[model samples]
Every structure is written in structure tokens, then in C-alpha cells.
Target: MSLNVLAVDDSRTMRDMLNLALSSAGFTAHLAEDGLHGLEVLSEIEPDVIITDINMPRMDGFGFIEALRSDDRWSRIPILVLTTESADELKAKARSAGATGWIVKPFDPAKLVKALQMVAG
Candidate 1:
């Protein structure tokens, strides 16, 4: 099955890289510039998995996760935090906000694909 993915990040390069990696892995990928945009896209696409950056312009990953967890329709979907922050405190915070997993930035494409499949497939 081709798992659908929604990736929220402010970096264009990261979005492009994710698009390439996800498409190469046969996953349908959607990109959003920020958490608010991610929410807007969420209205249109039912993604099995979500990958989001911690820092963003409008709504941060914590807020985004909180919003999703509050919505029954989207609460159970797997969310992976992809960020440059490697601090344990941040990971705990993301977990508290309802993240399913964590991935430090400069992610490996193969590992990312594997993680998505393991969680969403």
C-alpha cells in the first residue's frame, strides 16, 4: 500500500528532499510550509503519517500535535518529529504533545522510509 504522508516544515530544501525521498519510496507526499498550512492541508488529505519540524512561523510542532490530538478524526495518526534539536527535553515535550516518534535532523532517507512504513503501514 502507498501510505500518504503530510510533511510540515518551513524550509523549502527540506520539503524538496522529503518529497523526493517519499516519492522514491512510493509514498504519496504532501508538503506544508508551516503548522497552520499543515492544518489547512489536513482538511484535504487524510495522511497515514505526519512529519513535522519543531520550530515554525505560525504554529510550532507542539501546538500542531496538540491540535491534531484534540481532533478525534486525526488523533490516532502517527506523527514523527523531524528537527535539528537533539535535546532530550525537546523529545519529551514532543512526546507529551502526542508525537509517535522522533528523528533528529539530517535524517537518513532509508531510515525515514522504514520508520514511516513501520508506523503507518
Candidate 2:
């Protein structure tokens, strides 16, 4: 089955790039502008994996993960955090909030595909 993925970021460019990259890597991708929008999109599309940015308007990545984890239906969904923040503290926070893994920003498409494969597999 084709993997369904949700790419959540405040930047339109980032969302578009992720969508293109994931689609090229054989996954169907859905784009969301921010955490709040991501939640709304998730309600409509049951994605196999979620890739999100840390900083966003309305709601951030942490809020997104917390919300997801609180929901029984979405708690076990694999989450791959894609962010520019490389601080260990932030990584720990993400882990505590239930992110499955993380990928630093400016990540290569191939590396992202590998990470996604590892998480979604």
C-alpha cells in the first residue's frame, strides 16, 4: 500500500517541497500550513505518517504532538519532526511530547525518505 503522509509547516514553500519530495519517493502527501491546520487535515485524512515543523503560527509542533497524543485515535500515529532547531533540549521535548523521530532542517530528500521509511515501515 502507498504510504499516506501529512507535511505540516508554516512555510508554503516547505510544505510544497515536502509534498513533492514525498510524492516522488512513492508516498501520497497532504499539506498543512500549521499545527492547527494539520489537526483539521488529519481529521479528514488518516495519514500513515506525519512530518511537522517546530515553529509555526496559531499552534506549534509541540502543541500538535500533545494534541495528537491526547487523542486515542491519533496517539499511535508515527510522527517525524522536521525542524531547524537542533538543540538537544528541543529534541528531548519532542520526544517527551511523543514524536517518533526527528530530522534537522536542510535535510536531503534522500535522507528524509530514509527516515520516513524507517518510521513508517
- Candidates in order, TM-scores: namely 0.98, 0.97
TM-score of 1: 0.98
Model 1, poorest ten-residue lDDT window?
112-121
Model 2 per-residue lDDT tens digits across residues 28-84: 999999999999999899988899999999999999999999999899999999999
lDDT of 2: 0.93
Q: Which stretches of candidate 2 lie over 4 Å from their true place?
A: none
Cα error, residue 96 of model 1, in Å, equals 0.6
- Model 1 C-alpha lDDT per residue in residues 1-121, reported as the tens digit of each score: 6889999999999999999999999999999999999999999999999999999999999999999999998999999999999999999999999999999989999999999999986
Overall lDDT per candidate, in order of appearance: 0.96, 0.93
